[model samples]
Each structure stands twice: as structure tokens, then as C-alpha cells.
Target: MAETAKPAPAPEASAGPVSAAGAYLAAGVASSEADYAAAVEWYGRALSGDPANPALLQGALMAHVGTGDMVGAAKLAQAFQAAGGKSQIATVVLIAGDAKRQDYAAILKEQAAGGSAGAVLDDLVKAWAKLGLGRMSEATEAFDKMAKTKGLEAFGLYHKALALASAGDYEGAENILSGKAGGSFPLTRRGLIATVEILSQLERNPEAVALIDRNFQPGTDLEIDDLRRRLDAGEPLPFTIVRNAGDGIGEVFYSMANAVKGDADASFTLLHARAAAYLRPDNTEAILLVAGLLEQQRQHVLATAAYATVSPSDPNFHAAEIGRANATFAAGHPEAALEILQALARTHGDILAVQLALADGMRREKRYDEAFKAYDAAIKMVPNPGPGHWVLFYSRGVVSDALRHYDAAEADFRRAMALNPNQPELLNYLGYSLVDQGRKLDEALGLIKRAVLMQPDSGAILDSLGWAYYRLERYRDAVLPMEQASQRMPVDATVTDHLGDVYWAVGRKREAEYQWRRALSYDPDEKLAARLRLKLAKGLDAVLAAEGAAPLKPVAAAAAQP
Candidate 1:
């Protein structure tokens, strides 16, 4: 499910320039949503002018299959074939169609002739075909054959065992776990759970309990909880561990892939996960692992497809949707992501984590009202709110401030501060808000100073401190800190403008003009930009009059000395 790049649209010959751009834009949007029909229509419009464009051809192939238009896909494949346009995607689609038709022999013949299929997939599909033919012995042998491939033997051995157990050869499966099998597949939590079940099926309840305790003594999940209950009840559990060797290796790769974070090479990790998933079609863990890696690499579209494989019935469905939503947001499709989260909120109403996630997504998109509602719902749902609830209040406070709901914003900030006393961000934000409103100058200065002491390296906190001084009419005293703040946040127009004001108040007229110019170059808000322009045109006194703020006062001689 690694996200593929969206193919560029073909140049439109039939349509006017603006219409062509519109078609291209529409295709881009459709592809992002996986609305293949709409994407096809848009691409077709573009292709009317550039029929021979390879990018359009590639997009058409993807759109056709994504929409389940197999006939259309086949036609595209035929066209590509005639045009000598070879691609892995085209080949895979053809193989997939053959797979649907149960034409295994033909697939095998083609694979042998082509000699270019994904190695793991080639083995797995062949083994599955052997299963379809009711040739259990051959299927088992096929798995063994796959096991012989370098770096893939564990997968083969694992799937072979699952195939054995699934075929009702429980004793044989247990024997494989007992080390009768030549290869060793690394056991995972899931694998161990399956192994315990297999042991129970062999009437080895004691061994099953022992295995569960040995592997999962310190943690619990739904699977482990169920196993514990069965063990207590002395029930014979089924051997549900993968009997297929390919699946075992898939599990191994999937586990490794998930653990690959924070400095691991994403491409290498993806290769393992992809190989494992290819070897085992039903390996949701592997698919998710691939998606997670792709997301870490900022490959959003690929991550989305990988996450899409987790069906609603899967235990990890919520996790997958969360990943999918994050990828969609990362891909700059905030609306689609919000829609997904809204749907999830309805279905997973009782899940506090899901509600929080939805709220967080809304906050990221600056939908303050919607985010506040979600946060309220989350707060109500948590019967005994924990320390983590501070984040909700803090986030809500930010959104409230953005909406100019000062009273509510202050209340939320105070609430968060009470829960997590001396929190740097809360202090800085609340203090900055006060400073911006030109209210409670002394208290705001004190709060910002405290925040600065806690996080001196923070440019935002330093800016607040500088602005507070400027508000207090201590222009000379504001100069150094404001300059430091500007250096730390050199690109921030507000910081630069604050520095300019401090300069003008100290009678450094030329320096003030230079800073004002720099502030304009920083591209601040329209109001700030206008103020800076006025300051450059006349002086800080004129700008202050325009802003209705008190005029700058000269500092005492002792302060001016600095």
C-alpha cells in the first residue's frame, strides 16, 4: 500500500486553457479521494488533446481498476501492450485478473515465461493455487519450496505450518512447533497466541497455559485475554496459528517493520513489510506496517492505500483509520480527513481516544468551533479525567483565542495551568495574549518572564517579554531582549516590528526604519504590515496614534544608558 505518486494529467487539445487546467485540477482531486470514476472522466477530458501521453495512460489504468471497471482496465492494458508501454502495474493487474478467473496454470506458465514477478508473491500465489487444486501435499511442498528462497525461508515455513493446521493436520502442525520443522520462524505475540491455541488443540492445555505465561506474562490484549479465559475453563482451543510458511515470514517481516522507527531507513523497512504482505495476502499487520513506514516517509497516498486494507471487522480497524486520516491530512486533503474522522466518531462514539483524535484533527485544520465541540464530547466521555486532559484544555484555549473568545480562552488556559502548574506553553500563550490586548501589563510581564526562565531558548516567549517591555514604555530596556527575540525568530514580522518600535522609542530613527523595512519583508499580517508601513512613513508616534495605543515615553537616563 505504499502510496504511488499521482500521475500528471495530459495536455488538453480540445479544451480551452482554463478548461484544461480545471480538468487537471479535478483529476488531481479525484485521485486523492480514490474516486476513480471521476478521476477517469477528468483524465479522459485531458487525454482528448494528448491521447499519446504516458502519464494519462498510466492514470487511466489506475482509475479503471480502482473503480472496478475490469473491462476498461483490460482495454487500457491491451492499448499499453500495443503501444509497447510496459510497466509493473500493468503486469500486476493482468495477473490479478487471471487470479480472479482461477486460471492458476496459466498464471504459473506466464510467470515462468516472464520471470519478472515479485518473488514473494510469485511463491504465495502458486501455493494458493495448489491449495485450490485440493493438492494439500503439493501446497505444503510449494511452501517448502518458497522457504528455500534467501531471506524468505521463515515466511514459507510459517505459512506451511498454517496450511497444515488449516488442513486439519493439527498433530503435524504441533510437531512443526515442537521443532520437528527444519526452520525457525521468530515467534511474535500473535504467533505465540496462535501457538498456544495449537497446543490446546493437541489436548496439551498445560503446555498452552505455559506458552501463554512464557510469552505474554507482562501484558494483555484481547487475544491474550481470551486465551487466559479458555485456559482457565480447560477448553480445547483450535490451532489457529498460521499453518502456512509464507505467513510466518510475513509476520516476522511485519514485526520488524513496525519496530523500524526513529532513524531507521524507511525504504529498507518498507521492502521487508511489502515482501511479507506480498507473501501473505491476509497479513493485515504487514500492510499496516508498510503504511506506517510510508507515512513516516511522508508518502501519504501510498500509506492511505495500505491503511485501506484493514476491514471494519479487523481488530486494528480503528488504528488503521487513524493512520489513514493522518495521511489524508498530510496529503493536504483536510476536508476528506475530517469527513473520515466524523464518520469514525459516530461509529466509535464510546471510544475516548477516537473522539480526542477527531478533535485534534479539527484543531489542526483551524476549524475551531467543530474542534471545540469534539473536545467537549471527549471531556464528557472521560468519567475521571486524567493528567492528559490538560492538553485538551490547552488546545481549546488556543482555538478560543483564535476565535477572539478571550474570556473562554482565559478560563481554559487557567484550568490547564491549575492542572499542570508552571506549564511553559500555557504561561507563554496566556501572557502573550494579555500583552497583545495591552492589559495587565505587570502580571503579563511576570508570567512571560517566568516562561522565559523555564524556556529561554523559545523565541515566542522572548518576543512576549520584549513586547511587554515595549508596552510598559521601557523602550531602551526592550531593545536588547527584542533584538535577541528577533535573532531567534528572525523571520517573524511581529518580532521585527516590535524591535523597530523599541528602536524608534529610543530615538534611533534610522535603525527603526531599517527594522520596519525588514518587518515588511517578513510578510506579517495585514494590520501589522500596515502599522509597520506607517511607522516607516512617519514614526512610531504616528503609528501608535493610528493604533490608539499610548504614545511611547522616553525612558529614565539610567535605563537609556544601555
Candidate 2:
């Protein structure tokens, strides 16, 4: 046998001032938990006593930036750099500060001193700084050089197009944006909008309108619709995608944030996104990115605050409100979330997303009647429902089921299945519902079997399959799946209860009682817990007899093997 290892000794308690060691420890704990605000406060207290401690300064600096407190971070950056700290993040903060003041010479000086925000970003910033200094030829040359760099053609060409448009070279901008200069490059929503504006500036409003139509469906995006309407009316839209080099610099950070979103650490991505938003307050996309990242970090209050920053008159206001509602809900303010959606519905009822969100909020609150009506209103918005609309029907079916409108619920479920035949949740729900009601046993079994084949690891679906077998009096057939489901969802009250029932049906009386106790420990609902206690006290036979339920049919001894 292998020798057992002894536990490591814990650190001895510190005798230093609380502001020195204790504050530093607290900051580190908060930072590790991503509680940046608390970390910043603790770091401040620690730094008060230790001032130039490199680790304390670095921790404080990162905590400030993590909360998008650039002003505080800049001050910490100064202290950090003064004490010989060399951090890339400090360099970025100083660079952003210079960029904010439109001090192009300062930015160039920083770059000359070997300060960099990585290779690609450094090159992009150099080009934008050149443009800021009015060195048009130098900026264009730098952009062209970046375009020729293999695998980075899109970044250079896209920015070059924006620069040309800002300089009133509509033809040159159009050539690059329309992919006539070299080869086609991918365009983001902002890039597409820039191209549309450039086309309109060149007196090609018809082409701009057609481009908008090709990229965005009518009635889908309010901003796109507004653009299309203006273009159709023969309006010459101004090229405001990048009005100056400052906005261009902001775009660089925004682009970096988007690129690193899923691949990098969320805090790292948030730095870029927050920097972008700081440099250009009007960059709604950057703000949204910050809010979304905060939500992912479970900083729900911060996310809600960021979402609330979007102006009501802005085209993205609806999107922001929706995000705010979700963040509010996540922050344990479900009623506030419902209120936000309800207001959104009053203002933008024609929008499918708004209606769907409102319906979902009602459904979550168990306001089934209101939820069903809201879903009805949402379904009416889709003239011709397709596969993407499957969720709408599914949600309506769920609400209908809750309201005891079984026939309507079944019809809606069928419609949802027709739209997306292989959706495992839909299969499981319909099958489980049928099995629970003791109807359509064979069809229910087939549906659940198909669902299990698709999602074998789903504890809920496995539980449904096991319960179906129990209902069919196949005690032996029910055992394996019930045991597997119980293992997968060890703390699930319903699954534990089902496992207990299966055990009792198979004559494992002691195991049945053990599972029932476990189910009670997992906090089953009052009714479920009551029944479980009754079964444990009086046994399954008398309990089933009292409830007038069918008694378990005896199985063959060989078939009863656990």
C-alpha cells in the first residue's frame, strides 16, 4: 500500500499592523474571487502603510482596472512605474491616457521607448497616431504594410478603409471596403455600416440600401432599418464610423476585445473593452461587450449599471434594456426584471425578442395565464414561423401545461417538434409528460428513448426513462437507469424520490427507505417529503393503498438482481 502523506502546516499568524499584512491578505482574497471593488478598497488600505511595495501596487493597479476605474489605475500606474515596476498593463494605461488627451507625440514617444501593447496592436496604434499627426502618406503607408502582413490583411484593410473615408476619399474607401482593392475580408456589423455610409457619400444611395437589405433582414434591427429608410429617401449619410484618429484608436481596443473574448481570460478581455468604451463613449458595441463580460463574471450589479448607460434614444437601447433585465434577474431582483421587460413590451411590442422576454419572465414567476397570453402575442409577430421559432412554441406549451390545458399543450409541443424534430428537450418534455399522465405508453417510451440516445448524460431525461419503466410495471427494467440518474443528479430531490420508488418496486425495502431519507435530506417539496415520510413510516404498500395507486407487480427472482 502507498504511504499516506501528512498535511502541510498552515502559515503562522502575522504580528504586523493590520493595515500592512491583514489588508494585503484581504485584498488578495477578494482579487482571487473577482470582487474587484472589495479588492481595490483593501489594496488601498494595504498600500497606505506599504506605499511602494511592488506586489501591493501591482495588485491595486489591476484591481482598479478590473473595475474600469482608469482614473484610479492611472494614479497607481504612476506609483508603480516610479518604483521600477515593469508591467504591460501599466504601459497600456499610460498609453491610453496619452491617447485620451490626443497627444499623438506622447504616444509616439512611448512607442519609441519600447512600450508596447503587443505586436499587432502596436502597429495599429502607430498607424492611427500617424494619422492623428496629419502625416497622411505615412499613415497610409503603415496601413498598407500591415495589410501585406500575412493573416492580418483584414485588420489593416478595414482600418485603412475607415481612414480614407474620414479623409473624404470615398472612392478609395469604397475600393477597400467593397473588396476591389485586393481580396475580400470579413466585415463586422460596424464595418458593414461604414461601407454603407461610404456608398451613400459617393451618391450611391441605392447600392447602400441594397447592401443593408442583403446583410440585415427588415424589421430585425432598428438601426439597420433607420439606415435603409434614410438611404432609400436619397439621403447622403455622413461617414461617422471613425470621425477622427481617437475613435480609430478606440476601435483598435474594441477589435482586440472581440478577438480575445472566448480565447483569453475574461478580466484581460474586460480591460480592452473598458478601454474602448472609455476612449469613445459613443461606442455602444464596446459598452455592450463590457456589460456582457461583467455578467459572465457574475458582477451582476456592474453589468446592470453598464447596460443602463445606453441612452433610451439610441438604437441599441432595446438590446441594452434586455441585458439589464437579465442582469437584474441574476442579481436576485426577479420582479425588477419583469418590470423592465413589461416596460419594454409597452414601448416595443412589435419586436419579437421583447415579447418573448416578457413571456419568459411571466413563465418564470409561474403566472401561467399571463405568460400564455404574452406568448400568443409573440407568436403573432412571426408571420411565418420557422425552425428558429421553435422556442416560442415550446415555451407556450410549457405555460399551457402549467395551466392544465393539456390538449393545447400537446398541440403546441407537436408544432415545436415539427419545427425542430431532433431537439432533445422537446422530446424529453413531451415524453415525460405523457408517461406522468399514464397515456401513450409506447409512443412516450420511444420519444424518451430517442432523447436518451441524443443526451445520455442528462440526469433529468434518464430519470424520466426510469419513471416510465416503473409506470409500466417493469421494475427490473427501471433499476439501472434510476441508479444511473441518481448517481448523475445526486442532490436532485425528484430523481432521488424516483430511485426510492424503483427500489421499493423491486423489493429492496431497506435501500428504498435509505433513498427516501436521502430525498428528504435533499429538500423535496412539502408534498413529496410528506409522501416519502409516510412511505418510510408505514411502507410503500400501505402508502400506495392509501393513495389508491396500483401495487407493485412481483418480478421473477432472477430478474430482480440489483
Candidate 3:
């Protein structure tokens, strides 16, 4: 059976009326749960009403394209063109389909007509078509022409190096990286990795190691670690970067495509990113970008495959791993995600972020003790933990409490509070703990009151305040706060139970019983469940007698002289 998809926020409602056009627009903005079927329906409706509307035609074409209904996309594109509408999107779709169909001559003809698809793209496609037609010298000349263009030199140079390497010219690729060429591009991790591979292929292991060490140090990520190992082992790596003008233009489009992904048309974004990856098979970043776009469209399996393309030796491997883990978890395979994280942790032990990933994975698996150890490791790895690090302490506190190590849990909470004194969660958690222990009631109440002041709308903090009041026997005062807490956390079992207890303390028996039933339905804890059972079996009086707690009294009446 297929795994269920994770919940995502509902899509923003479409603007305007509920007409066919409006429905189509709404479908465009709908969550992935609505599926392409919904999009097709809406598009059909819009097209039926306004068959020649360019926007509606484009929308329908895209819906079909997304669903891999190529026949439909082609038919719509033909119809759209016959209606005197020149859609850049439709043209690109047609070009891509043509390429897949090996209609190279037609693709070249379209390119010759100056298809205003992409400036850099048109030139690159023309160059590749030349290469495809067995014109090597023309391809080389075309690549050189692109290399001379302003602001496009680096891209051209990189592709030139790849082309040289692919043609068994390792020395040429190395010369480019070594600045034997007139110009130089800043060596990003990807560029450096490719350079190192070229050097290694040329049997220059020392040069490769120098490049790796200079660009990627020991303390960063698993990919660097793996590269370091390969260098140490003196392994000969293969050169894999763009080798032609087509690939260079693809990189340019891919880079800009990533930045504009969610803000622009998905089909267009996918086109640019896919074109980049197609032109440069080893462009991991482009692949990842394509995967991200696919993820946004809810194509989980395809996204996962794209993410997996980032090899262990790529600098972006960690990023890919994270994406893969998230996809796996979203696809309802938490165990698979944990496995991936554990493997990453083993290889990337020195990186704090990797350890944090491990801790998150373990926590999701409910292995609290192991997760605590991972968190501890992560905390120790950081020289001076930031305010964000406080969450680690707070999370560990939860794990500690779950493990019945309340004293340790309190210490972690206090540490987190020290780091972020005004953090309402920490304040409420620690304050609630003290109240539950039935010790330091006054101090707990003060802390909880402060927490409530800090987060007036937080149901948990408000519940803590009410519970503290109930513990202090300020029963009448507890009623208002408890009711407010119940309003905020209407579905929370513990808060509902607390509200019921406060109601009973204030002599509202029927209301208290009603709340108790509500609490039970919400699945309260064993202790709360027992209290609710007792209240049903006997009364609040019997529960108080059994627990050996003092009778309700006003705060002033219960106070003692210091």
C-alpha cells in the first residue's frame, strides 16, 4: 500500500466570484491534496466558458502538462496557436516534446526563428543542435562566442572546461581551474569539487587534496568528510561538469529559476530547472532545485529521486539528505527517515547540525534517552550556545520528564530559562512542574503568573496559571483563568481536566461534571482519568480525601506569617 501524504496548510482561497474562471484560478492556488484532477476540472470549466482566453488556455495546457498528459498539452498548444496566441510556455513545451521525439531538425528551425523563450537559452540550444548534427568545430566556435559575452564568461568558461574534459582533455580542464586561462571564476564548493575531480582524473592527487582542503575543511559536512577520505585513499575521481554552451546557459537559467520558483509559474520553473539538469547531468544544485519544485507540486517520489542525485561527495549532500529525510517522513516512513539520519550522523559526527538531525529523528521515534544524548552532544559541540540553542535544553527537559527523571528535567528547564529568561514556554513548564509536585506553590504561582503575562493568548501558559491557583486553594480566582484556558485550549485534555477541577472547587458541580466528561473524551492522562472516574463514582470530596490534599480556602486565609 502507498503511504499517506502529510498534512499541509489549506491553500489560500482564490480571489473573485465562484465562476468557472474563478474556479480555475482557485485550483491554481489549491493545496497538493486537491490534485491535478481538480485542476483539470477547473481548467475544463474555464475553457468551456471562455475558450480563447489566453490565461485560461495556458492554465489548461499547464494542468495537462503537470499530469503528464502530453497529448492534451500538444493538442491545446495547437489550438492556442491557431487562435493567434504565441505562448512562450506552449512553445517551450512543444520544443521539449520535439527533443524527446528526436526531431532535432525542427528544434534547430525553431531556434533559428529566434524563439523569445530565453536569451541565453536560445543560443545554447542552437549550439547543442549544431553538436547533435555532428558539427564539432561549429560547437566549439559557438562555445567560444558565448565565452566572449559580457557577464557570461564564467558560465561559458566552466562549460568549456567540461567539454574539454569530456573529450579526454583533462589537462585543459585543470588549466582552467589553475587559472592558466586568462579569467577566473570564484571557486564555489561545486566548482572546487569538479576541479578536484578533474585534477584527480589527471593523476594529480596532491593537487586534488590541496583543492579539497582549501575549499572544504574538516568541521563542516559529511560530503567534505567523504571527499577527505577519498583524497587520503588517493582515489581517482571522474570529472563531471557542464561541457558546452548549452549546459552553461542551462546553469544560468537553473540558478535564476531556483530564486523565482514559488513566486512564479511552476511549469516555467520546472522547465528551466529541468533544462539545466538536462544540459549538465552532474549539476547537483540544478537537480535539487528541480526536486524542490517537484516537492512544492506534491510529487514526493520524483522529488526524492532528484534529491538522491546529490552524491555523498557533493558539498550539497547534507542539504539533499535533509530534503530526502523530510520527504520520507512526509511520505509516512518515519523509520526510513531515522535510518537516513543515523547514517548521516555516523559520517558527520563532528557537525552539530547533523547531530541535531539525529536528535530530531530519535525524538520522533520516541527514543527519548538516545535523543537526549544526541542533544547533549550537539550542545557541547557549540562553543557558545545561542538563544536558539535553548530549545535543545527545553526539548531535553521534556525527554527527561518522560523518562521520569524530574530532577534532571527541572535543571534543564532552569538552564533554558537562564538562557531565555522571558521565554514563556520555559517559565510555564517549570512553574507547572513545581505546582504538580505540590511544593513551592507560591513560587510556582508567581512564575506561572509571569508566564501568563508574557503570553496572554497561550493556552498552555494560561492553564499553568489556573492550575497554580487551584493548587494554592484560590478556588474562586482559579475559575476565571481555568475557563479562559479552556477557551484557548478547547481540545486539550489536561487543560479541560484542570478546568473541571477548578469548577468543582468553586462549587459548580454540574458544570464540573460536564467538563470532566469533555476531558475524558479528549483523552486525559491516567491520573486525570482516575480523578474523573472517582468524581463520577463518588464526588470531588472523595477524590480530595483519597489524595490527602487540604480543603479549599482563600489565599489570605491559608497564608502564614513569614
Candidate 4:
């Protein structure tokens, strides 16, 4: 899910030279807001006034890198180092610059001189540098050393397999990737793709197909499906996971970014992802990773720019466009975002993910008719609908309900339940709808109880369960769950209103009126608001009598029933 952009933190005014202080403060504010273009501008101004300031140099370098200007960042890095400054980011940028130039010796010299870019990254870069220098034995030895280190075995083994495949030692790479040479380790999407390519080189297309099938499902992942289709056609895939030493170094940075993503600061991960893209601009995976991290940080404009860099011909182009739509939406341009998805749906309509994304966007925008059509197109693309396709049915059901096609909505919801019987959201939605219509009271209560069992902490599900009991006239049974639901969702207008209704049925008239006031303060729909006001003025019984509805049974009377 894309985060809505938040206000940028205010930068403290620096107590420095007056001109430099203003520039520094402006740059800091821009950077905090992820306005890298403005940050680069302000930091450049700050650097011009304070040429030798280490902090200014570092900030400028980061801003340039964030904009994907590796050439500019390299120049600032050199100036930073010339000023007696030391930084891990500088080391990473310099190493990437050297790799781009194919100057492996410089990278080795930097490492030998104790230029560190994190322990794991430095070690991986050293191994790749050795490979670039044609010192195969040293490279293998360095990779072995990394594998022997605790907590880094997976990365080391995975890269060693890639290096072996790049060197045309397919059998050796297969041994490592197949877990015959080393213990089992998880493979990332890139790692798995590399393995499939290696298998194809060895004329093991069947095994590659099986590998793809085992890891991915049909109509789910377009990239995986494309690879599988080509492999099944007996196409010989060339090993290109790492085309050269530069790509190997890029992979090292990309791997580190993947490793530290959720554990490290977003900016820290961005540094690694940027370095990866700088080293290998053709690496769509790295570009997507950079865009995703920026989106996570609510830098929607920057993320959209990053996503735009993925070429349309790339297999992951659909994925990039989806991400771009999300960033665009989060940037507060819903119309533009919807257009992007609409265009993607036209071009890649056969791809399941694209259609689903378009449908979801339509649903979010409350275009129920268009959403229903998009969902139908997506569902038709599935070869045989299975349990994993429950979301498609459920989403279409939601649109159906919104469009007042209750029969179609019920059918779709039942279809979703048949596909995924225990899905709590589907259960709660269907059960609550049944209760609201005063139909299937017993079955509605049972379905809601099941949903509550699965998601005890979900305020919506609890509300549904309580509402089911209240509709069945079990007022006392409804009280505890409704109160619990209100507590869980303290400010939800509907839950508070339901709690008020339950309280009134149980003869807690004063508390009932208080809860109705709270619900009104929470801003319910106009229809519910008018009803709540009537109940407040004339009391629950008077309002029910005016509407010719059955009055709430007393708690004692409800409990006295069988």
C-alpha cells in the first residue's frame, strides 16, 4: 500500500556563516521532504559558499545520488575525500564509479587501503573485483571466506553460483545453486531466475520449467510465466544474470539492499539501490527496488521518476507502471494515476496483475461499473479459477454490492466463499449484509461467529457479530461484543451507533444517548445522522414506532427465550 505524503520536518536553522546557514537549512528541509532536485540545488549553493565543509559535501553527494546522478555524486565524493572526510557512502559511490570505468585495480586498492562500505558489501565487492582482475582462484577463495562467515552464507553462496555461471562453469554453478555444494539457502526472485537460466544452459529445460512452476503460479507472475513459456518451447536462454564484473558489483549492492531493507533506514537502503542502478542501468530489478523504497518513504514524485526509467520493452514494465500509478495516486493526482493504469490495462490486458490493479483503482475511485468490468476481464484470464483467485471474486462482489445488484453480489460472495471458505473479510461482509436485511438470522450469526474466531481483534468483524445478535433480538448477547467492537474502533461512527442501539435495547437509556452523541460527533452518513437525531429527540421506542418497526425486546424478555 502506498502511504499518503506527510508534512516534511522543519529544519533547524544552523548557527554558521549567515549565507551558508540559509543554504544548509534549505537543503536540509528539501532533503527531508525527498525533493532531491531542490536539495541538490540548495546543497550546491551551500557547497559553493563553504567549499571545504565536510557536512555540506556529504549532504550534496547524497542529494545527487538520490537523483540518480552518479557522475555528479562521484565529483562530490572526490571533493569530500580531499577535505579529510570519511564516509561509507563515499566509499560505495567511489567503488561504483571505478566499476563503471572497469578499473578493478582501483577498487582493490581502495579496499586494501581500508575503505569500508559495510562489512558484507566490502567483502562481496572485493570478491567481484578479484573476478574482474581475472584472478579466478582469489575470487573463489574470497567467496569461500564469505560463505564461511556466520549470517552471510546465503549471499556468498548465491553470488559464487552467479560468478561460476558467468565464467561458463555451468556445472560448478549448478552444484552450488542446487544445494549440493553448500547447504540449502533461499533464493530471491533474481537468484531463482539465474538458476533457471543456468539450468537451460545445461539443457535441463524440464527442470527449469518445474522450478518456475514450483515457485510461481500461472496467471499470477508475468515474468515467471514468460520465462516458463520460452523454456517450454526449448529456447536456450543465455546466462545473463551477471553479464560482467560491473553487473556483479551492481548485484552486490542490490543484494545488500535486499538484506537490510526492512531492518535499516529507508535512506540507507536507497543508497545501496542507487549504487546498483548507477553501476548497471539496465538492471530493472534494481530500478524497481529504488522506486519501491522511495514510495515507502512517501517520496512519490521521486518514485514515479524512478519507475518511469524502466523501459517499456522490459518484462517488468507492467510492474513498474503499476508502481508508478500507486506513487502518482499517493502524490494526490488520482486522475493521472487512473489513466496510467487504464493505459496499462489496454496494453497488457492479458496479464492478471495489470487488470487486477486497474480494477482495484476503479474500485477505490468508486466507479463501480468500470470496476466490475475490469474484474470480469481479469477473472476471464485465469485458466481455472482456484482458491488463490478468491480476491478477484470478492472484489467484484464489493463492486456488485455498491451498484445495488444484490443478487449478483451474493452470488459472487458465495463463489468467493466456495473458493476460500475461511476468509474472515468475506464471511463478515456476507454475514453483516444478511443481518442488515433481517434474513438468515441464525446462519448470519454462525458466519459472523466464525469470522470473529478467525479475527478476534478486528473491530469490523466484531461489529458484524454483535449486529447479527442484535437483529435476532438477543439484546443481552449483543451488548458485550458491541462494546468490545466500539473499544477496538473507538472513533468509528457505525460501531459507536451500534453500541448505542444495543445499550438502549438493554435499558441503559442514559448511556445509550451518550453513545449516540459520540457517534454523531464521529460524523456518520447523513441518513444515519438523521435517524440518530430522531432517536435522541424522541427516544428509541418512539422512533421505532414512527417507522412501524418492531420495538427492541427487553433484555429480560430476550434472555427468557429458549
Pick the TM-score winner.
Answer: 2
Every model's TM-score = 0.62, 0.93, 0.62, 0.89
Number of the top candidate by lDDT? 4
Q: How close is candidate 2 to the true structure, as a TM-score?
A: 0.93
Question: Could you give candidate 4's per-residue lDDT for residues 1-562 as a string of tens digits?
Answer: 2454544323333354446777788888888877777788888877887899999999889988888898899999889989988899999999999999999999999888778898889888989999999998999898998898899899889989888988999999999989999888999989999999999999999999999989996756777888999999999999988987888999999999988899998889999999999888878988998999888877788899999999898888999999999999999999999999999988988888899999999999999899999999998987688898998999999899889887898899999999999999999998998898787889989989999999999999999988998999888889999989998999899999999999999899999999999999987989999999998999999999999999878788898875
lDDT of each: 0.72, 0.87, 0.73, 0.89
The candidate with the higher TM-score, 1 or 2, is: 2
Per-residue error for 528 in candidate 2, Å, reads 2.2
Q: Write the per-residue lDDT of candidate 2 for residues 388-454, one digit (tens) a residue.
A: 8899999999998888888899899999999999999999999988898888988998999999999
- Tell me how far candidate 4 lies from the true structure as C-alpha RMSD in angstroms: 3.6
What C-alpha lDDT, on a 0 to 100 scale, does residue 475 get in candidate 2? Answer: 83
CA displacement after TM-score superposition, residue 479 of candidate 4 (Å): 2.6
Q: Local error of candidate 4 at 50, Å?
A: 2.7
RMSD of each: 7.6, 4.7, 8.1, 3.6
Residue 154 of model 4, lDDT score:
91
User: How many steric clashes between backbone atoms does each model show?
Assistant: 25, 0, 1, 0
